[model samples]
Structures are given as C-alpha cells and as structure tokens.
Target chain A: MEVLVTRQINKYFYEPEKFQVLKEINLTVNRGEFLSLVGKSGCGKSTLMYVLSTMDTDYEGQLEIAGQKLTGKKQDELSAFRNEHIGFVFQFHYLLPEFTVLQNVMMPALKQSKYAREDIRDKAMHRLKTLGVEEHAHKPSNKLSGGQQQRVAIARALINDPDIIMCDEPTGNLDTYNTHLVFDIFRQLTSESNQTIITVTHDDEFASKTDRIVQMSDGRVVV
Target chain B: MAGNRFQLTFEIAKVHLLSKPKQTIIAMLGVTFGIAMFIALVGLMTGLNDFTEDITMTSAPDIHIYKDITKPRQSILQQIYPNDMVWVYHQKPKNELTKVRNAKKIIELIRKNELVRGVAPALSSQVFCNYGPVQLNGYILGVDIMEEDKLFGIKSKMKEGRIEELLANREGIIMGKGLAQKLDTKKGDRVVITTPEGYTMTLKIVGIFQMGIGVIDNVRCYANIGTVQTILQQDPSYITDINIKLTDRHLAKKIAAELEAKFDTKAEDWETANATFLTGVIIRNIITYAVSVTLLIVAGFGIYNILNMTIYNKMKDIAILKAMGFAGGDVKSIFMIQSLIIGVIGAMAGLLIGYGLSVLISKTPFNGGDIISLDHFPVNFDLKFYMIGVVFGVITTAVAGYMPSRKASKIDPIEILRGQ
Candidate 1:
C-alpha cells in the first residue's frame, strides 16, 4: 500500500533573487518501505523532506499521506493530522533538555490526547525498553550522550505508532558503531512492525544499507 | 485527555520559566509593585474621603429646610439704564426679607414624619457686641438649646460653662472664644447686643467655645430663640431655618427632595451643602486611578519585554515542538500559562506588602495640626481594594503575555529548522 505520494511538486526561494529550488518533483513511497533520500548539500533534499513532512506548506504541490489529501488544509488541521499519522526525528535529537527521557518520549502521544496518561506512560516505557534506553528513562535528556540521545529521539518517533516516520540525518552526528546500530533498529522496525520511513542523510554507507535510496542532484532526482 | 493536554502545556511553561529564574522574578516584581501601589493609594484616598464626610456631616445637620431668599428686585434705574451702562442713583430702603412662615406648623408636620429623627427651628440674626468702648459685629444663632444640640452635637463641643446654663437663663448667651477675646469679656460678663433692626439689649455670656474653624470662632454666637426674636421685634413663631436630623444620613438627599416637593420650600442636604468638598473627592479619585493605571501599564511593558526576549531565545525549541505535532494553540497556551502563574503569585505578594504599608502609615501620628485635620493618615482596609489589586495584576500580566505568545504562534517551523 502506498503511504505517501507527491506529484509535480515545485518550490522557490527569493532571497537575493527569485529561483526555483525544487523543480517538477514526483515521488511515492510504499508502506513498510525503509527509504533514504541522499544528496549533496544544497541539492534540495532537505527542502523536499520538509515539504513531505507537512512542515512547509508554501510549496506548490499535491501531498497525500496515509490516504488523506493534505494540500490546501489549514494549519491547525495539518497539525492534528500530523499528530495522528506522522512522527519526526531531527539531526540534533531535539529532545526537551529539561524533561526526562521517558517524558520526552511520551510528548507526541500526550499531544495526540487519544490515550490515557497512564497508558501513554506504559507505552513510552515499552518503547524505551525496545530502544535499550529504559535504564535512563528517568534521567534528563541532556544527561545522556550523543548516541543515547539519538536512540531516545527514535523512541519518541515510534511512541504514537505513526504510519510514517520522517527523519533528517538520523545518524549524521553518530560514530560508525552508533550508525550501524541505528540502521539495524530501522531495519527491525520495517521488517517486524512494517513502519514506513523516509530519511534524508549525507552518509552514503547508511543509504546503501537501507531498503532503497533516492539520489538527488541540483533539485532533480538522479536515480 | 483534556487534563493531560493542559498538564503538558503547563509542564512546558513551568520548565521555561524555571530555567530563567532572574528574568521571571523581575517580571513578577513589576506586577507586584504595581498592584501594591494601586491598593495602598486607593485605600488612603478612600479613607480621606470618608473622614471629610464624617466631619462635615457631624458638624452640620443632615438636611436644612429654608425658604429661598429672593433677589432684590431690579432697580428702576437699572431697568432704564441697561446694557452695561453705568448710572448712579440714590439708594432706597431695602424690601422686607423673605422669612420662612408657618414655622410652628412646618415643625409640627416635619416632626410627625417617621424618617425625621429630630427637627429644630433656628432664627439667626446679625448683631453687634459692645463693651468697654469696643464694638464687634457677629452672627447669633438662636436655638431651642436641647434640639439644636442634638442636631449639631453642640453640647459635646462646648469648651467653657454648660449648654444647660443658656437654657436656664433667657438672658444668657454662648459666644465664640475669639469673639469673646475681641470683646475682652469672660463668662458672666455683660455685653450689649444690638440686632440689625437697631434694637439693643444686655446679655450675659454664660459659655465660650472654639469650633476649630477660624471664621466660626471669630464671628458666631448662640442665644435663646425668644431673646433673639424679642431683640429683632419679631413674632415668636418666626424662624429663619429648620434643621432636620434623619434616621439615616445617607437618606438625606432623598428626604430633602421629598420635603422640597411637598412644602414648596428649598431643602439643602449635607451632600449639596458640601458640593465643593464632594467635587474634590471625585477629582482626587480620578487622579488616583489615572496615575495607578498608567504605572501598571508601564509594569506590563516590563513583563512584555522579558517574555518577548524569552520567546526569541526559545524559537528553536518552539519550531521543534511544532514539528512534533504540537498545535500553534498549544504553543501559545504554554506561554500564557506561565504568565498566569506569575501574575497570581505576584499579586498575592503585592497585596500582603500593600496591606502592611497601609497599616504602618495609619499608625504614624500627624503630631501637628496638618492641613487635612486628621490625627493620623487614614487607611481603609476594605477587601475590595485587594480584590481590585489582584484582578488588575492578572489582567496586566495576561495582556503582556498575549503579544509574545502570538509572536511564538506565528513562527514558521521550517524557517527556524533551516536556520538551525
């Protein structure tokens, strides 16, 4: 089943001058597929990822995610939709530094407001245990090392059991060991739970290990 | 689910505020002092107003009934020489004064009313006091002694001799301290009193008192009504004014209106008698509110500045929260909750501080006869003042918070992430 589709997507930036940054892009991703978006810097890979994640609504495009048309939706509706069906991980592991790891993991589910708080807490603990960070669940996020923080971020992304997990450089700041560990976790999530993932990364080795890689150059997908 | 969302928002707001203790404390202090000043100053002003009303109402009757004095008829010469033309003419004898008639009947009618606590008929006349080759002119208020004393608390104000002495001897009079000094007379001294009608009589001074008002001490005296009427060669029933005390002083205006409509006479209540003082009270209140509200708004600006800086510093965090599926309203509510917490705590502290200050001021003595005539600074401990302070503080902080929250809500997540 196709989980996301983007057709004729175009984006422009008018900083010093008006210029097209994303040109007539077309893409689709199937459920349970672990895909990676790889490109050089300034190749519009991050821009396309942001547009697909429903974070950038300014692009002229049609975006359908999880069988719902998302284009032309109001900001609040998009926010609710994203809360229910999408999860995000960033390069910096954007966990609230003041919150415990467990609390940070439960943030998205709490915002969804569909489950009781105790149930959300139990699910959060379970996700942390799966990521092998349950021992540090009560510790503040800032107390953890870089690799541990990235793992916590991944746990947070899976807390809501979302249809799609969108990530920007999931292992960009990790060492080789942590990179392989994160890749193995993604593989297990795709094969066992059939969680769809779309990630943008600069690491060619990590992309090669994924199910498939979409390469981009100068705002167009080259392969 | 509803409870969970608020808890989430409150948790985030609490973390943000606690992380920057110095700025949050500064913002709280702004609201604190603003509310303190408002409560204290308003309390003091209200106390002063109450004090003034108490003094005036104690000294004067709640309502005074009298016939309206008619203006002198336009002179025939003024009729002929109109439009700013000046013409000199020989002065003619003045017409008879308009005196309140049927005084006995009116007094009887007023005394029968349930609202009337007491009614006293008073006849006042301008007179001259002569002794030892010195003649000083003054006004004499003729009263039934007991009734007038009850109406104006004159018995309590007597400084020398007894009010009953005036009632015992029809020829005895009570003169002001300064008037007695000017006449160089003491109690039991005889002074020749001459009315405006040129009738003279000898009267003994039985009492002397000082009313604290310079003009009243200098020119006022009291005598029996029969003596004054005999000196002026008027009938016993003639009286210039009727002073009526009411069951409730606040009902004076309403009673005065009814009396005026029923009796075809002008009635003056204490509120109308002290119009200038009432106007002063109203103007003072206006200035107090204006100054306090302005200061509070300035305090609100201090809160705004702090929150605005916090929002700017937290832009990256806000972007990530939005990317995590937190709605814009949720983001805005987090900041608003922080402001509300600060407002509530600050206002409570301010009320305590302001109340302590007011009590301290009320305890400090005036020591000397200051302009306000109060022995100490009057401070009212009305609960409404505290309520006003808390409400004002909360509203100010909320408004201050709203602007920065709106700015936080409008930030584009993608733009912030890109910048990062």
Candidate 2:
C-alpha cells in the first residue's frame, strides 16, 4: 500500500523575484520501500523533502501521508501529526547537546507521550542497541563522534515507530565508512520492519544502493 | 495531557536555564536588587512619615475649638452699607473676650456625638513666671489632668513627676522642660505665677514634660483648671478652649467646619493646622513610589536583554525542537517558564533581604538633638509593601519575557534547518 502520495505538487519562491521551484511534481512511495531523491544543486529536491515532511506549508498541492490529508491543517495539528507519523534525520546530528544520548533519542517520544517514561527509555535503549550505539546512550550527545551521533539520531527517529522517516543528507558529513553504515541501517529498517523512507542525497553510490531512485533536473523529476 | 505537555516543556526549560547558570543568576539578581531596594526605601520613608504623624497626633487635638482673637474683615460698617464698599482707615480694634461661650453646654453636646473620642476643656492664660528677680513671660494652660492624659498621652511625655501628682496637689503645675530650666525650678519647687489680669498665685512645680517641639517646650506649662481660673481671677465655668479627639482623624475637617458653623467659634482640624507637614508627607510618598517603580523597570529591562540574548543563542535548539514536533506555544512556554522561575525566586529572596535591611536601618542609632527625641531610625515593616514589590516584580519580568519568547515561537524551523 502507498504510505505517501503527492498530487501535482507545485512550490514557488518569491524573494528576489517570483520563481517556480517545483513543477507539477507527482510522487508515491509504498510501505517497506526505501527511496532516494537525487538532484543537482538548487534543483528543488530539498524543498520537496521539506514539503513532504510537513515542515514547509507554503505550497499549492494535495499531500496525504499515512492515509491522512495534511495540506490545510492548523500548524499545531500538523505538528501533532508529524510527531505521531513522521520522523526526521538531518544532515547535521540535531541532538540537544545538553541531553544524554538516550535522552536525545527519547525526546520526540516523550513529546508524543504515547508510552510511559520508563517504557520510552527502554525503547530508546533498544533502538540504540539496534543502531549499535547503546554504549554511548548515557553520554552527552555532543561528546560522541560524528558517525556515532548520526547513528543516535537514527535511533531517535525510530523511537516513536513513525510510519515514515524523511532524511536530508543523512550521511553527507560522514566519511565513507559511516555512509555505508547508515545505508545498511536504512536497508535493515525497510526489510525487517517494513519501514518506509524517503531521503535526499548527493552521493550517487548512496542513491544507487536504495530500492528506488527519483532523479530530478531543473525542478522536474526525470526518472 | 496538557499537564504532561507542560511538564515536558518545564523540564526542557529547566535544562536550558541550568545550562547557563551564570546568566540565570545574573538575571535573578537584577530582579532581587530592584525589589529589595523598593521594599527598603518605601519602608524607611513611610516609617519616618508615621513617626512625624505620631508626634503631630500626640501633641495636637484632632479638632481645636477656640475663640478667635481676629476681628471680622466684614465689620459692622460693611454690614450696614449692604452693597456699598466701606473703607475705614486706621480704625482702632475693640477688645473681646477670648473665651468660648456656653462652654459646658457645648462640651455636653459634643460628648453626645458618636464620632467624638474624648473632649478636654482648657483655659489658656498669658502668664509671667517669677524666679528670683527675673520674670519670664509664658502661657499657662489649665486642663483637667485625667482627661488631658487620656486624650494626649501626657503621662508618656512627663520627664520628672507623675500626672496624678497635679490632681493630688491642687496648687501644682506641670512645667515644660525648657521653661522649668529657664526658671531654675525643679519638681517640688514653688514658682510664683502672675496672670496678665494681675492676679498672682504661688504654685508648686509638680512635673517637667517635654513635647519635643522647641517653641512649645520653651514657653508652655499646664495646671489644674481651678488653679488657673483662680490665677486669672475668673469663675469656675470659664473655659477658653475645647480640644476634641475623634474616632477617625480623617473626619476632623468636616466636623471642625460643622462645629464652627454651629457654635460661632473658630474650629481648627489637625490637617489644617499642619498643612505644610501633611504636604511633605504626601510628596515623600510620591517620591518613594516613583523611585521604586523605576528601579523595578530597570531590573525588567535587564531580564529583557538577557532573555533576548538567550533566544538569539538558542536559535538552533528552537528550530530542532520545532522539527521534533514541539509547537510554537510549547516553545513560548519554555522561555516564559524560565522567566517566571527567575522572577518568583528572585522576589522571594528580595523580600527576605529587604526585611533584613529594614531591621538593620531601624536599629541604627540616630540623634535628633534637642528638637526631636528619637534614638533610632524608624522603619515600617508593612507586609503590604512586600506584597506589592513581589507582584510588581513578577509582572515586570513577565512583560519582559513575553516579547522575546513570542519572537522565539515565531521562528521558522525550515529556515534554520535549511541553513544546516
């Protein structure tokens, strides 16, 4: 079944002058599918990722994620929807430096408040174990290496069992070894738990390793 | 669910504030210093005001009913002329009795009034105290000793002998400290007194009292009404003044006006008699409030600046939290909670410090020389001033916090994340 669907999505940037960024983009991704969106610089792939993640609402389109229409909802309602259904991993490890690694993973789930605090903590530890970063769980997030911090970010994204995970250059700042580690983790998530993912990346090898690739040039998806 | 959300937000706020311990403490101290100064200044100023008011209240009656010695501006000639203006150049003044007429009946009527606390009848006479070969001119006031004591607290002012001694010895007189010193007479010494009417009497000095006012202490003395009446060669029914103490001193002006119109006597209220002093009290209070509020506002500005800088520094954290599903209101709440925490804790500390400061001030020795008998500074420890200080401090901090927190809440996560 399709976990996310976008119909004729169009976006514009008004600064400097009126400019169309995304042109009638139609996309769909099924459950358990891992897809990569690749494009040249300023080709609107990041903008599309933002629109799909429900963070950028200034667009003209219809977006349905996990069978819920999210195009015209209030900001707080959209935030609640994002909390329950979508997880994000950014290029930089966006862990709160003041919190422990385990606390960083538990932050979103605590905000969701769907589980007891102890259960959330246990689940966060389990996710860190799966990501092979459980040894750093009690350490402050900023104390970890770049690759270890990225793995912790993935653990945080998985703590709430969201329907979809969106990533913006998840390993762009990582070395070759860390990039392969993150790609293998994404592959395992999709195969083992039927997790759906859509990531924007610049690495051709990383895009080729995913199950599907949507190539975009000049704001239009070509393949 | 709301409780849980607030708890989460408060937890985050706690972590944020804890991470910057120095900044938080500095902001809190700003509020603390402001509130402490406000409490201390207002307490001391009001204490001084109350001290002065007490002196005035103790020595002066709420309303004094006496015969006016001033001749009427509208004379019989003006009354007869009706619409015409009549001018009398260098007209000689006519003598009139400076005594309240029907004194007994008026006192009885005033006693029936529910607002009257107590009434004391007195006869005032200009007298010459004879000591050796020198005679000093002064005024001798004749009063009922017990009634005067009850109304003016004369017993507290006595420096040498008891007020009851004047009653025991009908020929006794309570002389002011300065007047007794000038006459070189101590308690138990006989001083011959001659009234302006040339009736002479020898009276024993019974007590030396100090009223803390230079003019009154140097020239005034008190005696039994019968003794003063005999010294003035007057009958027992003669009374020159009636002093009335009221249940509520604020009603003195209205009651004085009413008494003046009804009895055809000059009635003076305490406020009218001490108009300039009352004005000074009001001006001091205004200055106290103005300075206190300004201090609090300055402290609020300090909070504003610090909070604004915190928000600016926390831009990345705010963006990440928003991306992680925290709403704008949640972000706003986190910062507001931090501000209020500082305000409440700071205000509490300020109240304690302010109380300590007030107590220290009250214990500091102060000598007012010969004019006023005060040994230490007066500091009013009124709870209401503390309450006002804390409430104002919190409000000021809340306003200071709101502007920056609102700016924080309006931050767009996409912009910050996109930059990364």
Candidate 3:
C-alpha cells in the first residue's frame, strides 16, 4: 500500500504577490521505500517536502497518509498529525537548545501521545542508542557536534516510530564525517525499521544511496 | 497536554522574570505606592471624622432635644431650595420652662429608650439683673432643679458656688463667674429675673458655672425648671424643649435618627440642626472625598505603569505560552495574579504605615488648648478604605496588564522566532 501520496500539488508563499514555489507536482511513496528528492537552490524540493510532510498546507492538492484524507484541517491538527504520523529532521537540527538530548528526542511523542511513563523514556533512550548518541542524552542538545546533532535529529525523527520520515537538506551544513553519519542513520531506518525516509540533499553520494531519486528544477519535477 | 503546557510555561515565565528584574522591582514599587496612598487618605479622613464626632459629643453630649418650632424660611434660601420648603428658626423663644410645648410628653417619650442617661427640659430667656443700676442683660437656661448637673458636661466646668440649690430653693440661680462679677452680685445676693412679659421674678445667686466657650461662660444662668416655670405664668407641665443625654456617644446618631423618625420627626440633628454647623460639615466631607479620590488615582496609575512594563518585558515568554496552546485568558491570569499580589502587599504595608503615622500625629503635642481648645485630634482607619485600595490596585493593574499580555500572546510564533 502507498504510505504517502500527493496528486497535482501547487504551493505558494502567502506574501510577495503569490509567487508560486511548487507547481502541479505529483508523487507517491509505497510502504518502506527510501525516496530522495534531489535539487539545486530554490527548485521547490523543500516546498514539495513541506507539503508532503503536511507542515505547510497552504497548497492545492489531494494528499493522503495511511489512507486518511489530509486536506483543509487547521494548523493545530496538522501539527499533531505531523508529530504522530510523520517526523522531520531539519538542516539546523533545531533541537530546542534549552533541553537535554533525551528530552529533545522525547518531545514529539511526549507532546502528542499518552504512552506509559517508562515506555516513553525507554523509546526515546532506545532511539538515541540506535543512532549511537546515547552518551550525550543528558547534555544540552546544542552542545553536540554537527554530525552528532544530525544523528540526534534522525533519532528524534524515528522516536515516535512514525511510518514516514522527511529530511530537508539534512546534511547541507555539516562536515563530511557528520554527513556520512547522518546517512548511516537513514540507512538503518530504511533497511531495519521499514521507515520510508525521504531526504532532500545536494550531496550526490547521499542521493545515490536511496532506492530512487526524484530531481527538480524551477519548482517542478524534471525527470 | 497540561503537563507539557505547565513545564514549558513555567520555564518561559522564569526566564522572563529573570531577564528583567528591574522592571519587576518597578512594578512592585508601583503597587506599594498605590496601597500607601489609599491607606494614608483613609486614615486621615477617618481620623479627622473621629475627632469631629468627639468634639460634638464632649461639647454637646450624646442626646439633645429641642422644640421643633417652625422658623420663618428666608427668601434667599429659595435659590438653593424651593420656595415652598419651610425653614425653621422660630426661636421657640426660651422663657420660663413652664411656657414651652410638649416638654413633659417629650420627656416621657425619651425615658422609653433604655439608653437614656438623663432627660432635662431647658427653659431659656434673656434677663436683666440689677446690682445697683449696673445691670447686665444675659441669657438664662432654666433646667430641672435637680437634673441640670447631669444633662451635659456643664458640671465638669463649674467655677461654682453650687448647682444643686435649684432643688432646695425656688429663688436659687446659677450664674456665670463673669456675669456674677459684671452684675456685682456675690453668692446670696438677689437678682430680679425679668420676664419678656414685663414681670419680675427675684432669685438669690447660689452657684456659678464657667463653660470654656466664652459666649456661654460670660452671660448665662442656670436655675430650677420650677423657678423659671412659676415666674412665666404658663402651664407647669409645658416646660421648654426636652434635653436627653445617653450613655453611649457612638450611638448618638442612631438614637438621633430613631428619635427624629419617631418623636421629634420635624427636628434636624444638631449635626444637621444648625444651618451653619451643617454647612461646615458638608464642606469638610467634600474635602475628604476629593482627597480620597486623588490618592486612589495616584495609586491606580502606579499599578498601571508597573503592569505595563511587566507585559512589555514578558513579550517573548507570552508568545511561547501561546505557541504552547495557552489561550489569551491564561496569559491574562498569570499577569493578573502577579499584579494583584503586588497590590495586596503594598496595601497592607500602607495600612501599617498610615496607622503608625496616625498614631504619631495623635501624639502631636500641641495640648489642643491655648490659642483655642479643640480637645484632641483623633485618628481612625476604616476597613472600607483598605479594601478599596486593594481593589483599585489589583483591578487597575489587571486591566492594565490585560491588553499588553494579550498583545504578547497574539504574537505570531514564526515572526517571534524570526526575532521580530
């Protein structure tokens, strides 16, 4: 079954005279497929990803996740759904700098779900270990290295066991070592957990490792 | 969800507080100042009021009943009141006690109130006394022979020969020390008490009294109701207007109101009885009210400024709380609580300070004599003023804090994160 699908999606920024950013893009991802969106600057990869992840919904499209229609719901619903059904790993890590690594990873599930107290902590800790950043659990998230922060982001993305994971230039700002470490976590999601991860990256090596790559130019899918 | 809200909110509020300690201190000071103003004004007004009431009681006694005779209403009063409103100043011309109206009936009515300490009918008339052609025309108050000493504080100031002689002899009269000297009459000398009706009644000087009020001291006389009643050729039962003294001075007004509504329904209170005295009280009341309002406004503004600064400083934290799904109402509550606390603390402090100041002012050692005696300045703190001050601060600050905090809450998270 297709875990995610977008048909004829069009997106625009609210201001600046409705400059269209994503135009009539159609895409589908089956269960457990690793999809990579490859593009240069301002080519709508992030815009498309924002729509597909249901974060930015000021768009015209028929989007479905796990067979539930996703349209016209308010911001609060979209936010909760995003927390529960999908996860995001932003380029900057965006791990609330005030919190510890353990707290950061537990944020999505802690906020949106009511699991057992021990289960929540265990799941958060387990994901941190899976990404091999368990030693940094108690440290402030911003103190982590670029590669380590990206790893923590990936761990946070999978902490809720979300079926789909989206990354926006997940390794765009990192050393080569951190870049490879982020990719290694992505590999673990695809092969071991059947997490359908879509990463937008300009790094060709990272793009090549995905099962299929979608290329974009000037706000549309080119090939 | 609530836990998440609290944890996030608690963290944000703490950071907000620590970030601007100076503003917080300023807000606290604002609340304190507001409270202090309320307390001081209330204390001063209440204290002055107490002092005035004390003067009225000490000088005039608890209960005074006079004839409610209709006086000619002046035409000048038509400007302030309707021409139809009858005024009273008819001087039920104090003569011998026996010539007055309903004196015994009024006394009987007064005795019904268990609180009555004494009731004495008073007869007043002007008289010329003869001491070998050096005649002095002075006022005479003919009271009950035995009870004149009990009706007022007159006995306390008796520069006397005797006050009890009214009970023993029909010719006995109590004259003032100054009047006695002026008339050249010593004790046992006879003075002819002349009636306005061209009658002569002789009285032997037996006692003298000196009230501190110079007018009352220099030209007044006291004698038995019988001495004046017999000389006037009127009914013996109809003495002058009845005077009542009560045990509790504080209950005077309540008793006065009750009596006005019951017996002397037409009579005004001594508090409101004399037109000149009433006007003075009304003026003081107006001044006190103006002072109270001004003080409250100052306090209110102080609260307002502090809360405004608090809301201004907590903008970021308010945005965060809103993003965490807190309603605008919650944001308002948080700031309101803080301001309310500040108001309460300041009000309590002001109350203490005002009370202390009132005490200090009371002990102010002018002796209340000399130049002129006004007894002592009494100070009292009324609870209503304290409550009013608290409400003023909390309410004003809360209303003041409301708009700013709401503005903070409505801030867009995306814009705030962008540091706008």
lDDT comparison, 2 vs 3, better candidate:
2
True contacts kept of 2: 0.58
The most accurate candidate by lDDT is 2
Q: Per-residue lDDT of A93-180 in model 1, one digit per residue for the tens? A: 8888778999899999989889998999999999989999999999989999988999999999998899999999989889998989
Show model 2 residue runs off by greater than 4 Å. B83-93, B126-137, B181-184, B192-201, B213-215
What fraction of the true interface contacts does model 3 reproduce? 0.02
For A96-172, candidate 2 gives per-residue lDDT tens digits of 98889998999999999878889999999999998999998899899999999999999988878999999999999
Q: How well does each candidate superpose onto the true structure, as a TM-score?
A: 0.87, 0.96, 0.64
What's the count of clashing pairs in each model shown? Answer: 0, 0, 9
What is the TM-score of chain A, computed separately for every candidate?
0.98, 0.99, 0.94
Worst 10 residues of 3 chain B by lDDT: B91-100
Per-residue lDDT of candidate 3, residues B177-211 (tens digit): 77887787788888887777777888988877766
lDDT at residue B256 of model 2 (Cα atoms): 99
Ranking by lDDT: 2, 1, 3
Task: Write one digit per residue (lDDT tens) for candidate 1, span B166-217.
Answer: 9999999999888898899999999999887789999999999766554677
lDDT string for model 2 (B138-220, tens) is 89999998999889989999999999999999999999998888888899999889977788889999999998776778889
Candidate 3 CAPRI grade: incorrect
